[model samples]
Target: MSDREKLEARLVWERPEPASRPAPEPLSREQIVRAAIALADADGLAAVSLRKVGASLDAGPMRLYGYLSSKEELLELMVDAVYGEMASEGPLTGDWRRALSAMAQRTRRAAKRHAWFIDLLGGRPHLGPHVLAHVEATFAALSGAPGFEHIDSVMLAVGTVDAYVLGALRNEASKLERGMNQAEWEAVSGPYIQRMISTGRFPMLAQVVRDATHPSADVVFERGLDCVLDGIAARLGR
Candidate 1:
């Protein structure tokens, strides 16, 4: 057989190219949303531009507009996507404290998974389905807790844990960006403390600094949750 005939016979239909596909007919909204989410995850929210997202999907920025109304809508969608990462169930046992603790730990783990999610504003509630699911789950966890009488107290409790977790994660991101190990950071900041000690301009500040430590946020987090639970238990009369 001729070379052309032999080549035609040997062609593999199932081995079609991924990158060479004709951009998948019409672009999907889910496609655009996934591309946008990944862009923010890889680079950061600041780096997520419509053009960049479209380029990733082998399309143009105008195509993305057909999926999302605006950049703000895209960001809101991405925020909900992160909330979808959370598990909706609490601890197996019916103990309120244990359930809440499990939730706080899981939520903190989610922050580590999606660092971009820390940018979500806690004061303003987003009504996205995934975010609403998260709220429903959290309230369910503390359902029988004594002091969680109303949504206000429940919100305050959840807000405290979320605020602590978000702030801690942001600080962690900052330390990572500074490109120094914890020991190196402490060593560099140590000299400023020494200078203050010797100058005595602020004796009280120096004393406090001398005793201060950069404890892992986990430690502070547990302490803060303990406080919240303590208050709740007090109200429960347990």
Candidate 2:
């Protein structure tokens, strides 16, 4: 069968009901997905496997196949589970800017909590219910805005937000993966950077590095988000 067909068959929301039988096993797809997420949370994505997840649940590795056919499926479900958290925040209010900004911040927070999540950001297609719900929320936020009446415009706006958030969080995740805080990163790299600046080869960059006051990550994120929203507003002529 095609991969799409296999995925459709295995979707947690689309699984068929089993024939009448004895009581259900203590294990479930939800349980398996949660176990995998916890593994990823504690030890990063590479540490997550059906074997490890099963051990955590006191079940055998083979037991996971009945719920998720492969590790790929497990990753997909884990991503959707995160999307579920984003969706549970409820629908957007009429103010698209505020709604989009709030969504971006929430996504940033989720990425921070689950650093492994950054690796999976836009890694594959997510047709899971929660992922679709999040998409719907994005559309709903921009639905009636002027100059965004076209579906393409709505999608572009949403995509722009997604792109910005992913790019920002990618940088954050890299720092985390390196186990270095901002100050430490600077301290370690500062000498080389200062030497490069003093060479006069990158005068503009050197000026900015020397003269500009670097903001905290949170402040930088908010400011970047505001700039993106301002661009969107200009496009919408709002």
Candidate 3:
């Protein structure tokens, strides 16, 4: 089986039955949200249409309108739900660097697990309760870090990590498509690497890849975090 096949076998976004459970009481908004979450958790986010969510809930798409105003609203809710899973209260124990690193790692892991999430997340950034909760947790994690005086600095720090994680995933997803594992990325890109070298057309670009250690998602993310932290520490005189 191909890697995609294995991924399909493993991550289920849609429930097996794809129908909502019968409830003893009238379906509350909470029930609707829960059903949507289950549907997304079982199936990839791409499959979580309003109709699909309602079908999973054993209701028609129109029924979902009674609660959520539109499909966009529902998607936002789902994003928020995913955010709810992030670590809420563990960021500020003692070591600030450790805390920041922990938060970055956890976010990276979360992105990898919910692989389709980052695709839709940025498209809608109004931020539901759950998304806010996760951001709050992230801020809390960086609370005592240097240069967090204004909310802008904090937002910038969080955005930097978020961008780093998302960028890393883009590379990973591309590799997954091309069957280019770590070793393969280096081997396959070798020609592309060499072409620039011999051309001498772009010396700087050529040299970078010539000695260039082909970067991995982890390495890129860690380097980005280190740079950001270094800048923050510098500004704060830490």
Candidate 4:
């Protein structure tokens, strides 16, 4: 099979049910996915494996193959499940800025809820139904914007906003995964940084350390999102 066909094959939604019989009872695709997500939520993604998931389900690992062919397929389902969570939180607004901003913030919140989400992101396209719906909703919102008459403009707008969200969320998730909060980070590295600034060789760094107002993560995220949205508005002549 071609690459796209292989991907499609892995999508349980796309496959038709066998006319003769249903999947065996007491074990299901949904159960497997739910178990895997729970395992991932408690432990990191590394803790999730077919064996562990099967164990959680009180089934042998081989039984899981009836639903999921491989770990990669399970991951696709897990990521798509998170997208479903994002959609459930709220609907996108008619205004482009409102829609995009909401999406970025909502996605960040999702990452916070599912810390392993960042690890599954990137390196491949998410072709699941929920993700495709998100892409469609985003395109619809952007298309209604003033300067987004052309498809290319809409695509660019989506890409720009998505890039910012992914970068910011990844940064935040990485820190959390390291078991360090902002205060903890500062406590560990602050002494070395202050010592460096004391030499007077890094005046700008010292000035920032001395004068910059350290805001909460949420505030900083909002400020950065506003900057991105402002640039997009300027480009779109809104």
Index of the highest-TM-score prediction: 4
- Off-target runs (Cα >4 Å) in candidate 1 are 1-26, 88-93, 177-179, 208-213, 235-238
TM-score of each: 0.75, 0.90, 0.68, 0.90
Top-lDDT structure, candidate number = 4
lDDT of 3 by residue, 93-148 (tens): 54555666676677677667666566665544645666666677777766655567
Candidate 2 minimal-lDDT segment of 10 residues: 16-25
**Best first by TM-score, ranked:** 4, 2, 1, 3
Off by over 4 Å in 3: 1-44, 88-91, 141-153, 174-196
How many clashes does each candidate structure show, in the order listed?
0, 0, 10, 0
Candidate 4 structure quality by residue, lDDT tens digits, 183-236: 899999999999999998999999899999988878989999999989989987
Error of 3 at 107 (Å): 1.8
Can you write out model 2's per-residue Cα lDDT over 197-236, one digit (the tens) per residue? Answer: 8898999988889799888889999999999989999978
Q: Which residue pairs show backbone clashes in model 2? A: none
